[model samples]
Target: AKDNRIRFYTIGLGANQMQVDSILGPITVNAPDDLDEKILEKLANESGGMFFRAKSAKDLTRVYEKINQLEPVKIDQTYLQPKTPLYPWLLAAAFVLLLIIRVIQWR
Candidate 1:
């Protein structure tokens, strides 16, 4: 938590900044009551990240969206995706299998 190399994002559900400050400092185990702003702010501050607060469900979603906007994951779709058309081959195989089953049943 004290390391600065890693980045941490914290979301406080109901606790305000002041309340968060009071609860966080240096603790081995955090109680459930202080699990809100205190823990999140501490982790974020120590790791050079941000601490966001959300009081309600809507606010929570908004905070999460903001986090995503801030730090977006990069996906390399060009090389990671297959170039061949697999669906047509799969459909043709399935049709052939079904035709074979039908032929066997007729015999």
Candidate 2:
């Protein structure tokens, strides 16, 4: 990614263990045990990016906002020219020319 100038922003969510109420009773299970935070951190570090942990929706929103602030999109404003309607002027000119032609024909 360094050669291609690509960045990676990694995010890990939820906890490793979760509890659920079952008919038998309360059971403890693995929630995001498959998610390896160390791999994510290594990837972010290698790609020159950031690693974020979001436990809830609010934290995810904040992480997104921080990423936006860190790397804001750049738009080219050089080609922003205001558009002027030429059809209106062309229609007026055509009407004036038609009126003049009719006046000459009548005379």
Best prediction by lDDT: 2
Residues 1-107 of candidate 1 have per-residue lDDT tens digits of 44536678888765333223435564343335665567778778888889987766788999889989988999867766658878999999999999999999999
Q: What is the lDDT of residue 51 in candidate 2?
A: 100
By TM-score, how accurate is candidate 2? 0.58
**Pairs clashing in candidate 2?**
none
Give the clash total for candidate 1.
0
- lDDT (10s digit) by residue, model 2, range 59-107: 8999999999988999877876799999999999999999999999999
Least lDDT summed over 10 consecutive residues: which range in candidate 2?
A: 12-21
Question: What total of clashing residue pairs does each candidate reach?
Answer: 0, 0
Predicted candidate 2, C-alpha RMSD: 4.1
What is the lDDT of every predicted structure here?
0.76, 0.90
Off by over 4 Å in 1: 1-4, 14-32, 79-107
